[model samples]
Target: MIKAKDGDFFISDWLRNVNTLEYLSAWETMNNPDFNYGEYAIIRQSSGTNTFKISVKEWVLKTNSIGITAQAGRYGGTYAHKDIAFNFGMWISPMFQLYIVKEYQRLKTIESDTLNLEWDIKRVLSKVNYHLHTDAILKHIIPKSTLPESKKGIEYAKEADLLNLALFGCTAKEWREANPAHAKNNLNVRDFASIHELNVMSNLQVFNSEMIKKDVSKTARYKILLKSAQEQLEQLKKIDILKAVRKQNSATYIEARNKTGDELEKLTSESILDKNKQALSDFNKKLKQGLNYNPKDEK
Candidate 1:
């Protein structure tokens, strides 16, 4: 009761300032549908005079203001909307307003940093899971000594394409053909994949590894993988962090993993671009040879 009485006295004295009255009137006009503008104008006219004064309760009743409220009993005091309260704090002390704004910014930065860390952890996990999936294929899925000389290589490409089809709705080759410019620039489909897709892909890699160990048929595994991909991606889409992740496009590439014997290598964009240039030069030479052939020369 004593605190509430003190709060009422503070608010009444604050309301005696013409600027404070205008600020409150603006807040009420913006937020309260039923705010009494006629009463507000009369109050504004009489503000700043020695005889003029108003308590939180009187302000609420006269102007139908929802911005300020007076409460009684336990946990009771004069309360205002956060914006209004902040403004009132500034009216009393500028340092209080500065501290509030700085604290708000600090909390927001912490939230952003936490989200970025989560994304980096998930991306790293996906790459680790991919290695497991590849190892499973090498150990359990591919034949050791039974393959013919004609099919000596390209086993890894086929296994990778199966995963590409399940999550990306296209084989790696098909994606390359559809997006010629990106392919020419050495950009893979996974390079443009969203955070949600990468997260789901990580789960699918683990599932694939276990299925391969159990001798699951490619067709059966693919059907299950595709269904799981659709469901998981849809649910991840609804997460609020996804909006933040999407906005951060510049930081969103999954590092490419390459293996040689027992060593694992990370492929940088510059290295990929150099390879693309060499490949294009070789292709143009072969195309020129084909294009220059003439029937007369053959005869």
Candidate 2:
């Protein structure tokens, strides 16, 4: 994806650094083995003098920076975690790095608000829908005579997988394969699933639970569930994306002000991440539901 190569910081020589070119290349290399390495290596080692191998082991030796790395083989390339990437970004261009940090911080500011709003909304909606999925599960998963709390817990886990499969288009293991962008190779779509998808997932799990009892095969259920998820996403595409983003942004600002209808400044007084940032993700979801979302369908 990196058609251009530029170094902002030198892992060894302070003169070289990382930038957008590095981030994109690293992402491509990790996801696409056939990624144009001949093109990328030049970029990876483009530092005029600090051509140290991008190996994690090598980097530690060179700069004592414990993070940032270069991997090799069909599934390897240079990668830095967010912290290291921030360092690399600064190393590449001080102002550019600052901008990167600022923009990223902005995104996170927005995203964290989004995440918290999502968490709260889930807490609210789930309280009511918890039994919808669980009741069906209890009947299907338990023995007729007696049911234990432990057994109900087991049933929930299975139902959760079914939910993962429906909206995520993958089970837990499958999501990692599809999204190797993980810091730990364990990325679940739930980690970043659209509020709409998560909402639909709750409904799907119940639907899937019922389907399971009807003796539908897993493959059939998977196909049906995926179709349902896609259809739901498609239905929401009727709205304008930019408009939705702005509307949601406004709602987020207000919620942060209201602090989810609680004491605003005091409740989140210690958020070191974003000073005076607000919570509006639930508003985003509230507005976007049946109107817009799920990037897979956005395009």
Candidate 3:
């Protein structure tokens, strides 16, 4: 409320201004596709006259504008969109409008910084887990003295892909083939993994290491790893703490988890032993062809 020689000033008086009506009409035109332009045009034509006046509620009802709303009760007042509210504030006091701008920007900066810090922590944890995974592979699976250096590297890759297949339901190569655009950007299957998946993968790596040390066969190890992956994912989904944390981040954890579940369902449709037999047969054919093919024997 504002004091005046006439009496008290109301927002309706400001709404009668030609400039204010034009601004509101233009804003509605740009933002609201269903805005009643004919009603707005009539309002604009009738503005800035002694006989013309419109309340916020009437404006809303006539034009279906989302920029303002009128509430009814003891505590009720008209609420305007931030843009309209800011312009109204400027109409009342330019200094107050400046303060509003500064405070809003400050709050946005703090929010952005907090989100960045959380993402960085998740990224660092993933890297640490990668080191732990590789260390486990080297200790339990890699041949030490007999294998050539090239063969040692290949063995490491094979073990890593074993984890990829168990957890993601696709080998790294298969994932790359399925997502050529992502492959072009050099992002692997794990790179797109959600925070929950990464956490589960970290645990799987350590568990697989123990299985290797116990001389567990690859087939049995995969079954155990796959079961663990599904169970841990279900538990993580139920965790309130992770849900709260993920709300601050923009990533959709539930959607990612659902996608993971779909992939696992597809993989489970086929018998694991049948798939292994097919893979082994293909490997044997490749090995036989390589052994038989010699440059000297070729014409």
True-structure lDDT of candidate 2: 0.48
Better of 1 and 2 by TM-score: 1
Estimate candidate 1's RMSD in Å.
Answer: 12.5
Off by over 4 Å in 2: 1-119, 122-128, 144-155, 176-187, 213-215, 240-299
> Each candidate's TM vs. the true structure?
0.49, 0.37, 0.63
Residue 37 of model 2 has an lDDT of 52
Give each prediction's root-mean-square deviation over alpha carbons: 12.5, 20.1, 9.6
lDDT (10s digit) by residue, model 1, range 86-111 = 88777666677699989999989978
Report how far residue 212 has shifted in candidate 1, in Å: 6.0
Candidate 2 lDDT score at position 220:
68
lDDT of 3 by residue, 16-104 (tens): 98988888988898899999999999998888779999999999999999988988999988888888977777667767768988998
Question: How displaced is residue 138 in candidate 1, in Å?
Answer: 11
